[model samples]
Target chain A: MAQGMEIRNLSAWYGSQQVLKEINLPVSPNQVTAIIGPSGCGKSTFVRTLNRLHEIIPGARVSGQVFLGEVDLYAPGVDPVSIRRRIGMVFQKPNPFPTMSIFENAAAGLRLNGVDKRRLAEQVEKSLKLAALWDEVSNRLGQSGAALSGGQQQRLCLARALAVSPEILLMDEPASALDPAATLKIEDLIRELKKEYTIIVVTHNMQQAARVADQTAFFLNGELVEYGPSSEIFTRPKDRRTEDYITGRFG
Target chain B: MLHSYPFRKLLNRAVTVLMLLAVVLALIPLFSILWHTFERGWPAISPTFFTHLPKPVGETGGGIANALAGTGLLILLASSIGVPFGLLVGIYLAEFNPGGLGTVVRFLNDVLTGIPSIVTGMFVYSLLVLTMGGFSALAGGVALGLIMIPTVTRSTEEMLKMVPTSLREASLALGATKTQTILRVVLPAAIPGILTGIMLAVARVAGETAPLLFTAFGNRFWSLRLDQPIAALPLQIFTYAISPYRDWQTQAWGAALVLVTLVLVLNIVARLVFHRDGR
Candidate 1:
């Protein structure tokens, strides 16, 4: 599992409006990297570009090199669907397939690939356990996933992504819609998930980034201001802008 | 009896009376039709009217069995074929295209919907009726189905459009393929709305008489074949109305009453479906 990613001079535009501009970063494998910036700073757009999902928007385009290992994801011959399969993502809010059963929710990816029943059952069980949701939901796998609580829905979404066995997980504020307890559980799950998968998280919560991320990247106006060990970035950032962000002076 | 300030109070009373009089004016036509139809129609409605075939122009005490069965079968055929195709086009316009193509398709559907029913019947008559060498139930069903398409398409699109963007974004974000997201997430949430659309389309097509007149020309016999002229309630009523026999005219009014009842029932069902979903 090659988990680290190298992005070079990435820029994104929505129609005539440019959101992300000239971003460069290298993320380490089996580590938690957090991108923290103010609202409308293009943090979400930057994260979505990693999984090639940003292009789903109309009149939206990305330019520059995004390399997942030696493969340039944006290369002319590269397939966006395959890239997405390998680099799975979760959104800020939980959105389970409302019509599907809880069991089916965790098995969507395998089913999409036309996997047989025996393998699908194995993947669903493994993914659910991996997300630490097996015990709470073991009895009612036949129930509609829309019936689950907000926190459980987020976990279900995580299990769904994990079922595909993706190498990299890009979450755009995964726990922002969750309550404090649910947020803590999700943050803890992220820490646990990073043991095997490369995790990239974008959040506005400075404290959250400090607590869970192994590395922190502070961005301003779509530019990377500073990237370093979490302790160093939060305690002693090299750039004055980074210091100002961590110290709550200004975004 | 008239005194000071009588002008102001009299004016207010006059407005109240005028409003009530307007309501009564509206009801008079409706009530008159209802009473007149029932008064003349009941004597024609008997077990024989449902079981036995209609008698000759001057005779009485027969049935409209063929017309009832024909109407039912034609509606079934038209709605079954038209509803599914309309739903697919609607989903495409809402989820898949959502661009210039979708816009053009929707505009065309709306334009087709606004076309008069008789024109649709006439067109189908000229095309299928002329080609097939005569009027047939198949021709009528084709025309009715054409009329149904626009209504189903418009309503289904409106319902599917009501689904929130966040729901779609969330599904896509989870690495779901576009097919999986639409089938599993979007369509299920929009099912009730789609059903209501189907009901509305059904009602619109069921009450259509002008289209069937040219396509399914009145047949006295209960014709089972789609390739031949067939019996329908509206066509039978037309046949009965022109006859010099008072009995035939009364039977026509009876068939008309039955047709109105079916449309009213369908409208109620459609409203109920919409109400359940809206709540």
Candidate 2:
């Protein structure tokens, strides 16, 4: 069973510029939660803080606690590396390591963690299959990851993250750079993955949220305006700002 | 303002011709040097030119065998010291530095690169020769290695900087430590560029005669010991080129040709090896 995540008074800042306000939310286990907001509304920052990736940026600081099950990720003496290992993230852009072949890219997390070579082949195949990339790239594992199409490379990155078997997967606009067909494929993958891993997806496309998320959160101007079931949030948002934004009145 | 079609055509043709002339002018010196070296150095090249040590001033028919071997040894020693040190400093500047120490090191490296080769030789002479009591291959290699450091570091920094931050983030996101991220992803991505930098540094140092003048101090016989005075191709060429002996001068030209060929071969070999590995 996948572990659930809880965010408590989570605020993030890029130097003095606060990107995410004191936002508290609950992410259920084995379900997809989508965060939708306009550009610069802190949707990305919110998800980044969930996995402690936001602090990787210089001068980017996060305040408040993120609990993965019973453990607070921000607690003193907690290793961020271990936190990251248990919680995986995929970026908006498809950034498969260009120097590595498809096989190596898929196996990166496992290989870097010093997993034994004996089980590497099986794990790589399993991860690729989970990401739905095995059928397309199974024969050309030796080819450079960059040689794959944009959607395929993104999936390869997904496989890389999945190979580590993180309990939670955080994706920040994973399909924004992809075409419609590719976006559909990624949406399908996200839906499939939520069965095994807790997922937090930040997307600009509200329809994508409606299609993939079981629960939806609306953020605006660094504040959470609404949080509820995707059906309720999309069709009958309680907050005026959420309704205005979802009705395409403004970003 | 739009120009007339014919006038634009004429101007384009005139500019094209001028650019072509400039390109030819640029090629002239390069081709001329190769042509002259080939013409003058070809006759001196023989079986004995490679296998035999230099003959005495009044003698004829000897090779720069010792100098060739000495140059090889010096480069080997130099690369062993310079490449790793430079690579580490480069990695420090590119990946770990938060600003204070990195800025100072970068400035010092820039200053080091600008120092004249003779000055570098003098520095090494004072530091190594004066302390050790004599010029030695060790001192010479140290001099060349110092010269190589700045070039290698700058190139390495530049190459590593070109690796996208996204790649680093991706690796880190996968739970790889900073060191693991660098070794497994960042360094590999930047390797081709770094190799080019290393080759350029090696080529630049290979032709250095000033640094070896007081360090290697030119021997006529083979000496492989690091602590002993040694011969190098550039030092031998300088010694022979200024001498009154016609045979020795011919040998210097031959050595020059050989040195150029060696650097060229090194570059080509590096390219082939890196090309095979990089993709």
Worst 10 residues of 2 chain A by lDDT: A49-58
lDDT by residue (tens digit), candidate 2, B1-279: 999999999999999999999999999998898888878888899998999999887977999899989998999889988899999999999998558878899999999999999999999999999999998999999999999999999999998998999999999999989999999899999998899889878988898999999998989888998999999999999999999989988888999999888888878877875677555
lDDT of 1 by residue, A40-146 (tens): 88999999889888898889999999988889999999977778888878889887877679998898777777889998998899999998889989999999888
TM-score of chain B of each: 0.85, 0.95
TM-score of 1: 0.88
Candidate 2 lDDT tens digits, A103-190: 9999999987788887999999999999999999999999999999999999999999999999999999999999999999999999
Q: What is the number of backbone collisions in each predicted candidate, taken in the order shown?
A: 1, 0
B1-279 per-residue lDDT for model 1 (tens digits):
766697879999999999999999999998888788778777777777787777766554788899988888788778877898898898899888678888788789989989999999999999999998999989988888889988888888888888887777766765567887788778888888788788777777876789998998868987868898888888888888887878888889888887777777877887787676453
- Residue B206's lDDT in candidate 1: 72
DockQ of each: 0.35, 0.81
lDDT of each: 0.86, 0.92
Interface RMSD of candidate 2, in Å, is: 1.0
lDDT of 2 at A225: 88
Off by over 4 Å in 2: B1-6, B270-279
